[model samples]
Target: MQTEIIIAGFGGQGILFAGQLLAYAAMDNGLETTWIPSYGPEMRGGTANCTVIIADEEIGSPVVRNPQVAIVMNRPSLDKYEPLVKPGGLLVVNSSIIDRTPERKDIQAALVPANDIAEQLGDRRMANMVMLGAFLANLPVLSIEAIEKALQEHLPERHHKLLPKNYQALREGARYLAEKV
Candidate 1:
């Protein structure tokens, strides 16, 4: 199975790190994975996007022109990448920043109040992880346990102590989606 996911947001929102975590989890799950990030001056306040591909077979390219999932954390990101998502793909929107919905009818969009959820979790910075949880719940390619393990391995040693809180944030986001769907 091949799944291509695009995550976009402003700098310092953990958009790239979220993509990396997904790729690492895919690798830990014995799948081939690649993470391609769009960095540079545009990433300052404009837009930062990363494409992550996970497949049971070999991946042809790390860059994704059309992804199976688009996780957008800001209005600019949603405006830029929403149309690029493949038909029948999932679009995870951070409702805290985005007010509009995708115009496409073929794709399914999930508007998650990531910032609000993270605030409720006592750390607004975990908004990315909250979105990741929603992604896992909708995608179902990897288990929550695998993602938790991947987080533990991928986070820096200094940030290791916050793993449990992040996991809880993920669970809260997943539960929110579960209740909705």
Candidate 2:
């Protein structure tokens, strides 16, 4: 099976990092994966997004005009990607940053309060992890165990100290499940 995902938000919101984490997990699971990152010249506060494709066979391309999953971390990302999700796919929304609910009903939606959950867990920057957690829980394309291993094996050594907190954030986001906004 194959799964295509897009993670998007402002540049500083860890959009690329989140996609990298997914790629790492896919690799750890022995799946073929591709991660492509994009951003605007405005830098940190500007638009940033990444596409991740995981499959059992060689991926033909990194470009995905319509993804099976979209993890949008902000209002603008939501606006841009909502219409692009494939019907019957999944849309993970960061309710903490997005003010409006999704208008599409054909796809499954997970409204996670990522920023709020991260803040409650002691760090607001882990919102990306939270959203990723929600996506994994709902879709099952990649196991959380695989992601944890990726964190331990692939993430930089200096960041290892934050693993516990990051794991907690992931769990908390998963716990949210299919909550509606």
Model 1, position 107: C-alpha lDDT score: 97
- Deviation in angstroms for 91 in model 1? 0.3
Segments in model 1 whose C-alpha atoms lie over 4 Å from true places: 42-44
Residues 60-172 of candidate 1: C-alpha lDDT, one tens digit per residue: 87778899999999999999899899999999999987888788999999989999999998999999999999988898888888889999988899999889888998898
What's the alpha carbon RMSD for model 1?
A: 1.3
Assess candidate 2 and give its lDDT. Answer: 0.92
lDDT of 1 at 150: 95
Q: Listing every candidate in turn, what is its Cα RMSD in Å to the true structure after a full C-alpha superposition?
A: 1.3, 1.5
Where is model 2 more than 4 Å wrong at Cα?
178-181
lDDT of 1 at 180: 98
Error of 2 at 14 (Å): 1.0
Residue 146 lDDT, candidate 2, scale 0-100: 83
